[model samples]
Structure formats: structure tokens, C-alpha cells
Target chain A: MTNTEFIKSLSEKTGMTAEQLEPMVAQFIGAFARELASGRVVSVQGFGNFESREKAERKMYNPTTKSYKIIPKKVTLNFKMSATLKDKINS
Target chain B: MSDKVTLQSVAESFSRACGVPKKVAEQLARAFFDTVVDGLSNDESVKIDGLGTFRVVEVASRESINVTNGERIVIAGYKKVNFIPEDGLLVSNLVSDMPDVREDVVADDEETDVSNDTDETDIEETSEVDDETEDVSEDITTSEDEEPIDAVEAEVNMVEVPEKVEVQEDEFSGIDMLICTPESVEEIRLELEQARADAERKLIAAKEAHREVLRLEALLDKMEKSMVPECAEEEQTPETEAEPVPAMVAESVAKENLTIYEDIPSVAKEESAVETADEGQKAEEVAQTPVEPVEESLETVETPSVVETAEDENVTVNLEATTEEPSSEQEESTDVAPAEEDTKSAAEEAVQSTDAEVKQEDVTAEGAEENKDAQAEALNRLLSDKSAATPEPVRKKKDDGHYWIWILTPILVILIFGVSVVMYKAHSDKEKTELKQLPVEPKNHATPVKKQAPVVKPKVETDSIQSNTNVPAETTATEPAKSKAADNKSTAKPKTYILQRDETLTKVSRKFYGTKDSVRAIIRANKFKDPDNVPYGTEVILP
Candidate 1:
């Protein structure tokens, strides 16, 4: 399901208009991102956890050029599904 | 920000952002995730507009061995959820801000000259970690208050968010690792200890190598200094170019005596044989002339001294005399073949003896003195014989030789003296540069030692963090005292100042000493248990 389809279903279930739900969805995402940006694990009940993980810097060798390049450290968001959500999805 | 942001916190934030009722926002948050899960289960993927794509990837079954049992097994595969963040998100651009964060962390580490005590360092690390977390929380609150109203503003805020997050992550990278897995701290400590030990060993080896180079250079200087005098003595001997042959022969014989005295006896015997053969050849060539008997008697007299001295001067002098008398040139050419053969045999014997006996410097010196005496007697005999044979021609040739010698000797001496002075200047310059470098190397070594102190500080910081986590208030209280001691030390050595309201030891140290390390010394001097929290009007000494 794409974002529009998911939002349409959510608006229908909540009995809200797409216009009202669209802004609310944006607000929700903004809040979620803000929490994650603070280095907190955002845990949605029965869904999964969203956390930022650090990837250490590493050296990469280019065989063709015979030279080395340093890939700088990075912060990547990781998502691990809760066990209940995993069981629900698999079933 | 709390340690964990549950669904409730997200709803709370969402409600505050949209100015909606808390209950309605809570319901919306629940429904939002529920819809995402349902969408994933039905479509195997869910694409959120601003967030990212969530996909259920299929894993293929494969054969594998059980780790414990070491038996082959057909493993089952299942679906796994994967998240791919949108390209426009702040998290995707986190790497772009990493260099700045790294610079800040490195600068902080360099400025703080942490104590060697493991406990103190650990406490400092924990405090640093706490400070970083608080900074992140403060950033979050400020960002939320300045929440973006449109996509462009959100994008701008997104850029700001990641930069703050990156800084926090870099600042507490090691601390986070320690806190995440306690066991890895000890492992990291062991690795650090090994690295420190290796660095120290390498430093010692470098110092020893430097000393050896200096010693070798000094020996070369001594050898050069000794050679200058010998060159001066050679310059003092005023010989014409033709007579230089005899002077060269004398020098070579002196060198041979100095180097290989043990072979002198055999060399002398060979010299005697060569002289006899050369004289016989000369006598045969001179038989057609009236001077054959006189030349024959002169050769017989020269042969014994040639054997005793083992010097080439007699042969050279005879060759010079033959050259002056053109009739003997043909005889000299014929005599050269036998002379070469005899010298070759003597050289081979000398080489063999040299291999046998390599020592006895004192005996070589005595042999050189005796050889010099024999050379003087041989020279006197040759001069008397030449005078008796052709007195007028010998005197005329001597006058010409003395005039050339007088013209060339001073120029040669001056040139040689200038060369020696230049060489001495160069040697002295090199010694001066080396002396300067010797002092500088210790300072270079000292810098690395200071750097190593910071390296060891982190380990202790981790230790203190672990042990003092339960008594955070106490640690915080003690931290000020430590920083005050560092501050007082700086003041005692340098200047004095009154502490202002809201000013801490670190700020004062940075202002006065350009480093936060002096905070501990100031704290020690003031004897404050909590110097950072001290009264506003307290007087602090600066060093």
C-alpha cells in the first residue's frame, strides 16, 4: 500500500476527512523524527522500535585505482519489529 | 527526551504539535501504526510519504551446519521487515555533518588533560556522557518550539536536527559503547594498554637509534680532524712534479709499513731480487758505453739498502736518472718488464701475509722509523754517485727544480689550508645542527607522551562512569572540587581573578590558561569540594 492509500484507509477508519488527516499525519511523522533525532528509541506498541545507530568510519580500497578512501562515520536509523507484530505478520 | 519514546510520548508530541486533544491524538497514533502493520501484511510493503518504505523481504532456505553439534541441517527461511529511509530525510544526510563532530570531540579531548586515576577519568566520562545527553535534550526542546510550518522549513529543521544528533553521537561514541555492553570496556582497556606499551617500546628504540647515529657522526668528525694535519704536512714537502715519484714512493712505503709490517721481511727480499735484475739489465744495455762499471757498482751498493728498507725510492730515482740520460731510455723500457713482474710477486706475497697477521701497531711504527732512516742513507749515496758521474749537469738540474718548487709551494699550501678550513666549518655546522636536533627530539617525545596521557584518560573515565553511576550527585559535587584545584594551580603560577556569578572552573580555566585541564589544579589550590557551584564572589588564583 502506498502512502495515499494508507492515509485514505486511516481517515475512513477514524471518520476524519483526508484534508484533516493529511496534516495530522505530517505532524505525527514530524514528532516521530524529533524523538529519534534526540537519540531516543521510539517504540510503537505491537509495531517495532526506531532508533539511530552509529556506523563507525572504515577504509575502502579501490582495486582499480589501487588507492584507499576513508568512509566517514554515519548515523543510520534502524527498525526492529516487535515479536507480537512479527507473529501477526508471519501468520 | 527520555531514554525511550513509547507510543504515548509520540502521541503526546503529536497532540502538542497539531494542537489536538490528547485522547484523539493517542487514537490516531495507534491507528497509524496499526494501518502500517496491516498494509505490510497485505501488500508486503508500506510507503510513507515523508518517512520511508517498509518492505517484507523473502529469505531463501539454505543448508547449514549446527554450531554445537557440527551436523548438516536444512534451515528454514522466513520473511523479514526492512526499512529504507527516504532520501530527503535528515538521517540520510547524517554523514555530511560528521567531520565537524569529529573535530569538536578531538579538540575537547586535546584541551582536557585528564588525570591518570582510572576512577577520576571514569567519573569524567560519565559526566561528559550526561552532559551530551542533556545537550541533545535541549536541542530537541528548542527544535520542537521552532517547529517547521512547511515542507521547506521542515527540511531546514531536518538539516539542523541531524547536525546536533551527530555531534552528540561523536562526543559520546566510546561512552555509548561502554554503556551498551559493559564487557567490551575491559577488552578496549586491554587493547589500549597494549598500544601504549608498544608506543613506549618504539620510542625507546628510536632514541637508541638516534644515539648510535650521533656516536658514528662524532667518530667521522675525529677522523676528518686527524686527516687535516696529514694533508698540511704533505703540502709542506716542496717537490717538483718529476721528483714527486720518489716522494710518492716514500709515502706508499710509509703507508705499507703502517698497515702491514709483518710482511716487510718477505717484501724486502723480493725488492732485492727486483733491484738486481733491473741493474743487470741496465749493465747489459750500458756495456756498449764507457759508464757500465760505474753504473754496475752503484746498482750493487743500492741493492742492499733497497732490501733493508723495502722502499720504491731507489728504483724511482734510478728511473729519473735514466730519463735525464736519453741513451738509457731504451734500457729503462727493457728493464720495466722485469720490474713489473718482481713488483707483482711482492704484492701477492704482501697480500698473503696481510691476511695472516693483522695486529701489532707498535711494531709497525718502529719498522716505519727504520725504513725512513734507510731511505735517508740511500738518498745520500745516490746524490754522491750522481755528483761523481756528472757534477755540473746535476747542479744545473737541482737549480731548475728548486726554482719551480719555490714558485708552486705557497700556492699549494694556501689552497690546501683553505680546503681544510672549509671542511672544518662544515663539520662544525653539522655538529651544531645535530645539537639543536638532539634537544628538539626530547620535546617531540614529550608531545607523544602528553597525547598518550589523554589516550589513557578515556579508559579511566569509563571506569569512573561504571563505579559512580549510582552516586551521580556525589560525583558531580566532587567534579567541581577537582576542577577548582586545577584552576587554583593555574592562578598560583600566573595571575589572580574574582569568580563571577554563573562562571565555572572550566570556563575560567579556558579564559586564563586556554585549556580546561587547569581547572583541577585551581580546584586543588582552593580546596573546594564543589568549586563549580561555589559562591559568585569567590576569589580564584590564576597560574
Candidate 2:
């Protein structure tokens, strides 16, 4: 299911308008983006952990060109399911 | 995990934004769904830029089954919405707390050491693999010591030696050579083990075959050892048996010769003079002599069947021989001529003896001769018709006795008497025929001659007996019955005729009767000894 589909499904379930639910979801997305960009963690309880990291410049292959290209050293987002969450998923 | 954000949960969160009632909010959500579906159907991209892009992607047509109707339907290439998450949203950290493993390679020409950072688990695995390989190599070396791998090792080297291996395929198999390296040490060990097993099996079979060969040789040796003594005994027995058989045959031949000599002394004497009769004489002398037990032992040595045939044939033949005539007559006739005086004396003696007991002895003698002739005929039938198997002259003497002497005695008597009667009738006829031919009348002498006939018969028989033994050259060359018949013919006549030169008895008779029809009668009337031999002017009787 997509984000809009998910939101629309929630609207049908609750007695709320799509406009009010839309702002709350946007605010949370914006906060998560800002904190991760500043090299901070957005730790959500009872869900999963997400973090940003940097990778060393390394050689990678572009399968379309079948040639080696340099993937530049850049920041990347990393998420790890917490032990409790991992246990819950496994269970 | 939190409650699943279904359409109901999301709509509750969205209801306050649209300021609509729950039912109106549900309608608005359905509208947004329709808008997304419509946009995708038009092949539009609904991009929520920071979150992700939802693009209408065309899926190529493929065959699929409609489960409800079980009908095959082709899902034509149609647009469907697909979402691609933003790069920032994709998690990059899957493994947590991974220690920094990179080594600093700041300067060139520096020895880099990352051993400290190497995984201990990987180290344990390498050591374990090395240990297993060492044990396996030890196993392979043991197998190599056990089996000579020359045949297969060359093939293995052939597979591995070439860097660019060119495989040679055999028509019989797809696998050329299984090249085992340190990487495949276990397989090499297993193959060596199999080879060792095959070698051991062959060795065992060869050993078994060798044992079988040894066993067969031993059996052959045993058989040869057993046969040696039996072969020696068999060889010796043939020699012993061969020696005795000839000795027995020689003894039988000598004994048989002795019997032959005893039967005829004249042959014994002549055989001595003419050939090797010394042996015959010795044999006869042996049988006749009472000095030695050689004859007795010979009798003992001869089988009972041989003795029976010899004694039976010998005694019966001699008894049937008409011993009235002495054996000297046979000997003298067969070989040397005895003196006339001796023959005359022998004949006189035989006649006197026959006359004294002729009637009784003749019957017995003829009866015995008949019996012997019957016996001889039986013997002839018993023998397959070989002239050699025929009994000797001594035996045949008995046969002539049956045909001529024994059978013809009574017949001759009856014939003589019947002739007298016929002669009486013939004389009557001759009177008429004679009267017709008679130039002179016949004197009546018939009754007077008839009165003299009985007396004349014996005297005539006596005369012939005397003449029979009275052979001018050899007195013993006599046929008794034949001579008697001739004498009877001569005695039956009254008149005589003189034969001219070269005349037969038939011619002599013809001179008296005018026709030769009376030739036989005339011949019968006179005892012209040989009818063909009427010597010139010889006296012939006319009946």
C-alpha cells in the first residue's frame, strides 16, 4: 500500500478529515529529516531505530555500462530494528 | 509492534484535516484512491518528492488463469502503480556495532598487516581444514604404500599436468580422468582406497587359483603313485597268461595226433616213413605203452567232452568196421601190398568165421553200422560244412558200410531170390524167344539147374570172396560186398560164351541171344568183374 492509500484508509476508519491528518504526518516527516541530516538519531519507541552514516569511497560496478565507477564518499541512512522489536518480529 | 495502520486507522488520523464526519472522511479517502488509480491508468507519476515516487509501470502481457472460471486469460500489458522509496529512506545499517576493520595504508612501500583484525572464526576454520587435510594426506600416503598406483597415477598426471587441459573422451565413458588435487584430497583418498580394495581382491583370487593348481598336482601325483604297482602287475600277468596258453594248445595238438595214430597204425607207420611220423609213433607208443603215466595224465589233462567224442567215435567206428576182415587188409590196400599167402589165409579165416555165424553176426554188424552211420550223419549236420571238420578215413569206412554193406545185404539177398523167380519166368519166355531163334531144340536142363542153385550160391560166394582178396597186385585191395555180388552173377548161369578181341560182356551176350536186349541180364548172369572189361576170349556166362 502507498502513503496516500494508507492515509485514505485511515480517514475512512476514523471520524477525521484528510487535511488535518495530512499536517500531522508532514510535521513528523520533516522533524525526522532534520534530525537525521544533523547527524542525530530519530529514535522511535516500539518500532525501529534509524541513523545516518558515511561510507568510504569505493569502486562499484554500473551493470548497465558493465564498467567500474567511483561511488563517492557520502552520507547514508541506516536503520536497525531494536532487540525488542527484532524479538517481536521473530516471535 | 503497534496496531496495523489499516484504512480505518489512517482515516482517523486524516479526519481532522478534512473537517468532515467519519462517513464523509471515508468518502474522501475513496476519492483519493480513485484519483491515484486514475492517474496510474493514464501512465502518470504521482511523486511525493521527499518520501518516494509512485509511477505508472507497464507490466507486459502474460498468461494467467482466472481461478473462478478456470479459464486462461492474457493480462495485456497495462499500467500499474509502483513506488520507489527515496534514497534517504532506505536503511544502510543492517549490521550493528561492526568494529572498524580497515587498516591504514598511508604510505607506499609499507608492509600492511591486517592479521590482528582477521576473524578468529575464519582462523579456526582454516586450522581445522588443515588438520583434516593432514589426516587425509596421511590416509592417502598409507594407501599409496599399500597399492601400486602406476596405472592410474599416469592418467591422473595426464589430467592435471596441462595448464590448458585438453580432455580426451573415450567412447566407453564420459568421465576421462578424475584429477584429485589438494582441494579434492578426500576424493583422492577414497579413490585410492577403492583401488587398494580391487588389488586385494585380485591378490586373493590369484592365491586361490595357485592353491587349486597345487591341489590338482597333488591329486595327479597320488594317482600316478597308485597306478605304478598295478601297471607292473598287469604287465607281468599278460606274460604269465601268454606262456600257459601256447603250452596248453601244443599239448592238445599232440594229444589229438596221438588219437589219430591209434586209429590207423598203417598211417602211423607211413607217416613215420614219409614225414614227421616219429612224433605220431611216439604218441601212439605212449598211449599203448603201460610203462609211463603220460597216457594217464594225458587222459586226465584232456577235457571230459573231448574224451567222450574221441572214445565214442573211436569205439563205435571200429565196432562197425566188420572186423571179420582183418585191419591188415585196409592197411595193405591203403599202403603196401601184403603177401598173397597171408591174404589168402586171412580171407579163409574171415570166410570161415562169417560162415559159422553169418546170420546172427551179420544182423548185429549191420545194425551197428546203421547206428554209426546215423551218428556220423548227425555229426555231419553238427559241423558247419568244412571238409576239414569231416572225420578221417577211419570214420568214412563206417559210412560205406551203411550204404553198401549193411543196407545192401538183405536187399542183395532179396534181389538174388527175386532174380531166380524172374529168371524162371524169363526162361519160359526165353524158351519161346529161343525157340523162335533156335536152329536146334533146347535140352530140358532148367529143373536140374534149379535143384543145384541153393548149393551153387554159397560156393559162388566162396569163390568171389577168395577172388576179392586175390588181387594179383595187392591182395588187400578188396571190396567185400562188391566182389560177392559179382560172384553171385557168375554162379547164376548155366552156359558160357567166349568173347572175341575187344568185346564187351554185352557183345558176348549178344552172340548168344541174337539181340543186345539181354545184355544186362547176361551181364548179371556172369560175374564178368568189370562189365566193360571182357578181355578177348574171356568166359562169360549165359543165363
Candidate 3:
């Protein structure tokens, strides 16, 4: 779903209006990204837990140059749908 | 805990919160992407209490990591986990309400749980005490929940039960009972103390019981050892100490024992073997003949000696007894047979000797049958005496003789036979060698040489005639020619010599009408040119 559609669904499920859920949904996404950037785990009750683990910076060879270079560690964000929320969407 | 991430962004927030790189965040996110993987890896269940839940599924291996590199790696392969949401979570204003969905679906299956999860904190503290107590009562078969505290509870129950009348089946009946008053608690405490003392006493008693069993077993083994030798001593004592009684009994039984003297050869061989064995020796040539006659006499002489020797003859009986390690009953029977045989031989020997004496007296007219009996008695007596003597000095003498006989006889026989064989072989060998060297081929060769001589004889005759004429001296023409013709005739004829009469050299020339000097001429004519060394008493060819 698009971000706006997801927010609208969340507003409908919690019986809150779209206007009220827009900021909450944005804050949730922002908070998730910031936590992911710092490499910490997030646990949600009635859903699942998320944890980050170290991945060593590797020497990845540049194919064209035929020489190796360090691939610096970078952060990536992720999303997981809860079983309760998935059931809600399916129903 | 305060601001936990929502389900949608939990994986994203974990990586951001931990400040790991995007690749690592993606990996962490992927795990949350699979909710089953996340719960299982963390060893936690995502239990939405009112909803159907996600659980940390147990598998053979939960996760794997590269130990060297410290990288979190998925344990490649499959594991079992799933999610089930409750009806409440699935429906609200945004979703349809399905009536078939359960109101509560979050209940865990404790019925299947094998044990309460023993948190790490409790294990180290209690395990030592439990293990020590458990080892001693290994047969009690208590499970995890029924651990060592049961013993303490058992002690507590002992106190509240009525004294002396409390039966063993009711041993743990009063456990967890309450006391109503201070006075009652005091009484129960006193009882508990007494119960503790009684338990100590019973433990001591059980130990004593085990020790007693051990002592009784040792005593039984000692008694068996002591009794065995005593029984053997009892069996042996009567045989030796009261021999006369058995002997008298043997005499009464003599009529029943007649077979012993019948087998003398076997008995003699046995005696011979025994003697040889004692000396560890061979057959002495002198002893061989004597051994037979002595064995024969053994039957006719002392009764006991015959009996003893006969006993030796049936060596198989005793040897079989030893080898089979016969049962007591079988051994008893085997021994009985030998004893009976010995008695009979002794009696027979005695009878033979006495019978001989009676015969010499010519008692044939009176009771001649009684004579035989009397001789048997005498022979028996003699046999007994000989047997007694033979075992000692006679055995030594016989043994010595036996050694030399057995050792030397075959060797001497071999030596004599060998010498004869060698002489025969040498004679044959010599005959063969002589035959090989004899003049077998020369006989055929010598005839050929003799035959060749005839071919050369005519040439020899012409040459001899010419030599005589050239050698002639003071001969008239006719005389010389006549002499030449005579020499030719003599050479043509086979050369033979003839003895002349007593004319000697002087007379021969005169008588023949030639001078003594002509004797030389005659000798030349006859080819007796060496006239001074001519063979004596022979003259030839006056010409």
C-alpha cells in the first residue's frame, strides 16, 4: 500500500480520523528510521521483535578496475507487518 | 520498553536504533519480514494474547553464525513457525467481523510442556545439594518436581503421627498438617525432635543389618572350607587304622573272588612299567625274560604280592578314574573293583603254593582236592611276602636293569645288522668297480693287431736271406750259394729252432764238415747271431 493509504487504513481501524492519524503515522515512520539508522532493535507487543546485528565492512572489488575497495557500512530501513495487522488487512 | 516500534516498522527501527549499516539493517529487517524467523531466533514468542499468535518455533538448530568472522548467518534450511491472528485483531471499522473466529486464541499448550523452564538463576544454586542427596536414593525414581525436599517432608511427617501405633503404610500421612496452639506446636516440636532421633536410630540399624549379612556369608564360606578337609580325613582314617578287620572280612569273601589270578600277563606288564617308571628308564635285556617268569611266579608265590601286582595291571581302572574325575559314586565303584581283584589274586596265590606242597606229599590218595586248596594258601602267603619286599629294594634293582635293557637292545641289534649291511654294500660296490675296469674291449682289439703281422712276414724273409749272403766269409762259390739257398729256405719256412746233438761248437763244425770258425757261420745261418748268449741246450741250421 502507499503510505497515505496505509495511514488511512490505520485511521479506519483505530476509529480515528485521517487528520489525527497522519502525524502519528509520520512520527512512527520517522522514529523507525532513526532507530534503524542507529542499529538498535525494536520490539512490538502482539507482533514481533526486531534486532540489528553487526556486519563487518568488506573489501568489495570494483569489477572494471580489477582492484579491491572497502565497502563502507551503510544503514537500511525495514518494515514488518504484524500478524494482527495482516489479518485485519486480509479480512 | 517505553516507545517500542510498531509491527510495520520494527525491523526498520532495530537497525536505526542500533546504528548498523543498511545491509545489516536489511538482514535484520528480512528476519522481521518473516515473523516466525524473528521470534524463533530471539527465543521469544510474539504472543498477541487475544489474537492468534506467532511463536518462537523450536528446531534442531535455531541459528548459525560464522564463528571466525562474527557474522550472523542464517542456518540454511527449513524450520517450523507460523502466525495466527485473533478475531479482534482481524476486524474493526476497517475490516469485516467474522463470527467463526474465536474470541480468545492466545492460550499456550502447557499440557505439552515437559518441564517448567528452569531459569539459569535457580539451577546453579540448587543443583549441588540435589545431586548429592539424589545419588544415595537412586532407586526412588523421583522426577524433577519431587526433588530432595521430599526427604525433609518425610521427616516432618514422622513427628505428627501417633507414637508406636503408626504403621509403615501411613509413613507420610501427616505431612503439611497445622498446629492450633502454642502448646500444640511445642508438643509437635518435641515429637519432631524425637522423630529425628528415631530415624537416626533406624539408619544405624539398617547399616548393622547389612554388616550382619556380610558376616554370615563369610562364616558360611569358612564352614564349607573347614568341613571339606574334615570329611576327607574321616574317609581316610578307617581305611588305614583298621586294616586287619578288612583283611579278615576279605578272607571270608575269598570264595567270591577267584578271577584275579586269571590275568597274569597284564599284571606283569604293569609291574614292569611301574619299575621302569620309578627309575625313569628302559628295557634291560636281562630283565625281559626274568620279568615274565617273575610275573608268573607272582601269581604262584605270595598272595598279597600277586594281589598288588594285579591291582597295578588294571592301571586303566585307576587312570580312568583320575582322568574322568569320576563322580563320587563312580569313583567308589572303581575302587571297589580293584580291591576285590586284589583280594582274589592274593587268595589264588596262596592256594597255589599250598596246593604244590600237598602234591609233593602225595596226598593224592586222601583228599586230593584239598591239596589244591592248600597249595593255593601257600602261594598266596608267598605272594604277599614278595609284594611287600618288591616295592622297595627289588623295585630299585629291576628298575636299573630295565633301563639298560630297553636302551641297549635295539641299538645293539641295529649295530650288528648295520655292520652286516655295510659289508654287503661294500662287497657289491667293489664288484661293480672291478667289472667297470676289466679288459672287455682289449680282447677284440688285440686280435686285429695279431692279424696285421702276417701281412709283413714275406718282406722280413727276403731281407734275412740277403743279410746272410753278405755276411758270408771264406765260403767257396758253390758253398756260399748253397748256404744262401739254405738261408732262403729257412726264412721261407716258419722260423723254428731245433736242438742239436752233443757236438758242441767244436764238434758241430767238424761233424758237419766245417771248421769251428764255421760255427759262427752256422749261428748266422740259423739267425742265432749272438752265439755266445744263445739259449742253452739248443742248436740249429748247420750250412
Task: For each candidate, report what fraction of the true interface contacts it reproduces.
Answer: 0.56, 0.01, 0.09
Best by TM-score: 1
Best by lDDT: 1
Question: Chain A TM-score per candidate?
Answer: 0.92, 0.68, 0.63
Best-to-worst order by TM-score is 1, 3, 2
Which segments of model 1 are wrong by more than 4 Å? B92-543
Residues B406-497 of candidate 2 have per-residue lDDT tens digits of: 34566689999999999999999989897776633332333322333345776646554444334222323223333343445454223655
Which DockQ values do the candidates obtain, in the order shown? Answer: 0.23, 0.01, 0.04
Judged by TM-score relative to the true structure, which candidate is superior, 2 or 3?
Answer: 3
| lDDT for each residue of candidate 1 in B37-149, tens digit (9 for 90 to 100) | 88888846999887889998777889999999999999777676788877535442233453564465444333221211322343344335334432122222222222212
Candidate 3 chain B — worst ten consecutive residues by lDDT sum?
A: B105-114
lDDT of 2: 0.38
| Model 2, docking class | incorrect
Write candidate 3's Cα lDDT for A1-91 as tens digits. 2334444544545566778645433333334433433455566554444443335668998899999999754323233445654343333
Error of 3 at B104 (Å): 99
lDDT of 2 by residue, A1-91 (tens): 4567546644555446677656544433333443454465544444334466768789999899999999766666655434543333233
Report the lDDT tens digits of candidate 3 across residue range B417-455. 999999999999999888876755554464332333334
Give per-residue lDDT, candidate 2, residue B127: 39
